[model samples]
Target chain A: MDSIEIPKRIETINSFKAQGGKVAAVLPIHYSRALFRAFDILPVEVWGPPEVEASYGGVHLQAYVCSIVHNALSFLKKGGLEIADFILVPHACDSLQGLGSILLDFVKPTQTVAPLYLPRGKRTEDKQFLADEFRALARQLSNLTGKEPGDDKLLECIEREEQADLLLADLYRNRTGLGLDNLSFYRLIRSREYLPAEQFTELAQTALEKHSARNPNGIPILLSGIVPERMEVLKAIEELGGFVVADDFACCGRRLYPKGNERDPFLRMAERIINAPPDPTRGNSIDERAEFLINLAQTYGAKGVIFYELKFCEPELFDLPNLRNSLKQAGLNSVHIEVDIKDPLSNQVITRIGAFLEILE
Target chain B: MDKIVALGIDVGSTTVKMVGVNASGDFEWNYLEGSDPRVEDQVDSFLQRFRTETGMTDSVPLVATGYGRKLVGQAEKIVTEITCHAKGVFKQLGHGGTLIDIGGQDSKVIIIGEEGQVVDFAMNDKCAAGTGRFLENTAGRLRVPLDQMGEVAIAARDEVAISSTCTVFAESEIISLIAHGVKVEPILKGLHRSLIIRVVAMVRSIGLIPPLMLSGGVVKNPAIRKMIEEESGEPVILPEQPQLMGAYGAALIAQKIAVG
Candidate 1:
């Protein structure tokens, strides 16, 4: 993700901390950025940093744990997150839930750890359940920080994040025309993980301004998975005569939250996360995920879906076969490729992506 | 005889194949040899020999395919073995169908469209169980020569089950079977069966489109074709030269630009 000098994670964290702002080391998938900001905490997410030596995390975790959880714990054990004032672990999947349990029950680090439970369905009661959970987290933050922001302050923060997300959605809407390569586009998208909403909005707008009719003529494909970890994958895709036109990756497109209409801040946040795109991690059905993927592919003119996934991720892996079958039945071709974040991008992966693109060609 | 005007070389893990096509893109000349560790040097020597023998001093468009395609410095283009194999077989067979290419390093089942384009495909990832190496490793372990593995396997009346799908683990299993006094023929049959089962599973995943053709150096083994037919219940087809499809396809792609 280049040509745009997007602020580094370390720089963002230090800047926030220097401003007397507390940093929350958030784990993957969903969390309330507005709520965290309301309590003077900056939520910078950790998606395995993926390159860490996982031995420290391996000491506490079972051998089967996904590298994201292992690397997060390993990174923490190695003092990677010592500066954070809080750690937020969302129950996005069983592995992440286990990570939260391990942190609370055993490898208790110094940061205040909180686990957020996301609602499975988009039903009214589901939204209410997630709202209540966020409310409880708000109470936890209030106790931990001894500073309670009023509804007005909370709403102000929500408005800022919503504005930033609106810009994110705009970026997605006009992604192809932006002339951003897979790596650069993803870099801009994932900058949301650490950069404050206001800052992300500025960079996103600048990217949109540099838009051109020079959208790459490469075979358009959709990427669906927990995360796109390796930079080589993007480079490999481009080199192979293809580019990601759409994504269902947990770290990027899946987190494109729509604006919530509720007046209550927590309910608004819950509405956004619960009503975001259909995802397997939230226990969404194969039919729902497949239908969404079909629509996504059609909307973006993607020839097929590449289920690029991480190894040992049960949620994504569990839904893979059925989801792939459903897509095939609908006349959408799909392929599954797994990667261990601890390892470098292998030639096999490049060849798989290469062959898939060749098929689409 | 037509004059050679285009070139394609497939630098596979176990072997290197370079095929020359005439102006109309029919295979006019070809070369095959064990893969050398120094692929660039190997390719250079191959090109030098081609120039000396063919007597066509002018350079033609060259397209490289396979794992070591990138190492071929003289190539004007590089295409993946998947596409090259599909294109090669489609032209040779006179129709589109599911084509399985089981190389020494990896295996792929590609669904070919009517126009010789790849429609859909599946590949075994980072594993040798579904590939030629699976049988090659076991052939050495069973003390059977690589070329005779098929004949020895086909003659066996009883095929003992080999439980391990991993190439390395299958070697250990073969040892255990031999220690238990299992006949080498049956063990060889079991290994072939193991490989076919894995490849067929990949074929089924892509929902095999028939005419069910085979390619790659591994398909040179007669038993692989017969067993694939048995396992898939679909007749398996073969081109004139199964091992040269990748290079042939690459040559065809180069031919369009070379003579046009």
Candidate 2:
């Protein structure tokens, strides 16, 4: 199969601008459809980067501060982000609030603050308060855009997005059953950004439809890693006759959205994404990562699991001790792969992964 | 007479320290700064040193402490640094002493009762804010030897306050201060004070009390000690070579086990 070439989105941004598209960029992860599509008029997120030279960490904040926020700020310092006409800042985490404040100071975007006030529902009035808040936010957006989004348009957009999501959810479901090989698994994750949500959904569905026709005679392997920036490493695993059917990485499998209740899609989507399995420990706390692998091995008839740890990523390193212990105790066939993103395309790592999978089978 | 001995080794990222205490609460021997790489190999060497240094190696029970305690061979008991440090501090200060231990890679503030048991503790393992690593980094940036930072900090006529909370940022801030004609003395003083503030925050989180016993290698720096006292509003009880306190505590635990 030939590799798919991703069209440059920069040219598309110009067309989007000419079409008077409202652009906004998302914060932290900065991976959002609304923000990306709003190319000309709005940037999804705006936040000041942390001073990298600061060694002690924030004196006021706890040491367990998320490094992702720091990375976002670092990228901003390097002018890596696209400028937006407006941005929506949400109080997602403590760092997000700090990033919002920093973004407000520097980015000079038409700032729209999204305060996620999760109500405990202790009192009936609290639930009412939340509903009122949500309505107010919608009203605020409507006022800012100067286009009162009718119920029909909103519902239509929701349905379209939901369809895309259902296809994605189906991909996850199929992968869960067939046990994706490490290489193909990572390739699929990388394939997501290259195609639009709808197109990606179609591709996934097509792939699943043809899964039975495709060769499944490979060693079943669980591909685990901290955010794998490069897709080739996963492909190398596939080339070695090992199929990665399961994973625990946050940047890939876990980040994909599954279909949610359309009656209240946005809120349900947010809830599902929030409730999605985070890494079991600090860093990538896939609490059920080991369990997921074991279950997949039993269900998909996997022979081994390959755990990938990124270099200098302490959170993953700390989790590995317990993860390795659990896998050993479970008597699950597994191998640990430590990957340094700096040496991403290393043949040495590929050879090791191949040898381990070969031995297990 | 046959002698009983128990060994306690604390393997830190930068250094390996071990102490052996006999059944009678006597210091049989002590070994510090073993070979790098696998610490299990170092333990074997330490055991050999125990016999060479003290001329007695008859069935000494071993208890391991610190991060690499589990990796050490045949540790009869594996205890956490929090427990060991608390026990060592308790034996020295005898209860109601807040322990401030700033080691190579991490910093910890432990509050203990009279029994030397940990009541509450807070640690900064993720960042080098309050740890010795911060000072090491800051000294390197300042081009001042770490051993000299203590004296330099103490000599400052006016302290140059640094606002950056991060140690990496603090070094640049220190350099900029120097470029702006700030005296080295005050800048160093400020740096030490910044570290003290970070540790003090952890101490406050764990709850502060009087008669603080400062432990860990960072205690070797008197300037840091003074700043900790000034910031904490209570003088720290100086343990002799506080870096050895954790090892000493492990030794004490070994002694208790051997005697029993």
lDDT leader: 1
lDDT of 2 at B41: 80
Classified by CAPRI criteria, candidate 2 counts as incorrect
Question: Model 1 lDDT vs. the true structure?
Answer: 0.89
CAPRI quality level assigned to candidate 1 from its DockQ score: medium
Kept native contacts, as fractions per model, are 0.69, 0.00
Q: Which parts of model 1 are misplaced by more than 4 Å? A: A59-64, A211-217, A321-333
Residue-wise lDDT of candidate 2 within A262-331, one digit each (tens)?
A: 3553454344344444443312343466676567567666667777765444556667657765776787
The residue ranges of model 2 lying beyond 4 angstroms of the native Cα positions read A1-121, A126-361, B1-4, B24-26, B141-145
Model 2 reproduces what portion of true contacts?
Answer: 0.00
Score every model by TM-score: 0.94, 0.48
Q: Candidate 2 — what's its lDDT? A: 0.62
